[model samples]
Target: MRESRFIAVKLISVLKPVIDRRRRLALIVDDTLMARSCSKKTELLAKVYDHDKHEVLTGYRGLTVGWSDGNTFLPVNFALMSTKKKENMIGNQPVTADQRSIAGRRRTQAQRPMNAVTVELLKQTKKVYYRYRDRLYDVKGLYERLAAAKTRQ
Candidate 1:
């Protein structure tokens, strides 16, 4: 995760010049499905609404954010959407004790209502961005301090 964050920071830095020149950049948010229909025993398998398909598909929904410049898209962050509640729409059937326990662990970070998942995804992305932003400022401050010390000598 940390590595991915650092890579995002690097990517943003590389794109900064073009972004500034165009003065237009988009932060895209999207959710996608990773179907697991063949595996009935797959952990956290649930009904996920596919907006484009206009139907509920049995799979995992992945909410992700990315930066785009009308052409190129750079994925910044992502979070898996899981419906682990006892009364979800599709996965209404009861599971055995062992399956329940496994599903519980799989749904540890479960968020509801789609909107909640989007909010969580944005929050996580914001966190990573701020962390890198702060680190950049710290480095700038250090550079300034070093330059001042050199001038004094």
Candidate 2:
């Protein structure tokens, strides 16, 4: 599907029975370094701290959120993060400020704090839950319908 929120909502619903049995539910948030050192043309590539290797690495950080009732864990949402603090340029070559394009603007916005990104993901999850909680159709049916609609175009 085009929207990840819908899939997240479905996954959450499937795990609802397991979650409801527990007295407390925990939302887990974490960021992982996806190594892409061989890539030179990737946008938003930056130096990310790798906890496992105890060193800095070049790659993108994927921030994710999941729900756990101490047993069953379900990933709900995620966002790619970057540390590209400045506009893209041709290696050390001088460029005017007017040369910054839409990609540069997006890179700056993608540098948001981890907490802010987590909060945004949680808000989206809550919204998806409330909007579809009362629905009766299964996820398979919903996806099939969506597929059919796409083919009609």
> Which candidate leads in lDDT?
1
Per-model C-alpha lDDT, please?
A: 0.59, 0.58
Clash pairs detected, candidate 2: none
Candidate 2 regions with alpha-carbon error over 4 angstroms: 18-20, 87-109, 130-153
Off by over 4 Å in 1: 87-106, 130-153
lDDT of 2 at 142: 39
lDDT of 1 at 77: 71
Candidate 1 local lDDT, 1-88, one digit each (tens): 4467569868887877666464456566766688766656555577776666788778777766776666677777766776856554
Over 81-136, each residue of candidate 2 has an lDDT whose tens digit, in order, gives 77645543212212222327754443444576554555566566676654222212
Q: How close is candidate 1 to the true structure, as a TM-score?
A: 0.63
Q: After superposition on all CA atoms, what RMSD does each candidate show versus the true structure?
A: 13.6, 13.6
Clashing pairs in 1: none
User: Ten consecutive residues with minimal summed lDDT in candidate 1?
Assistant: 131-140
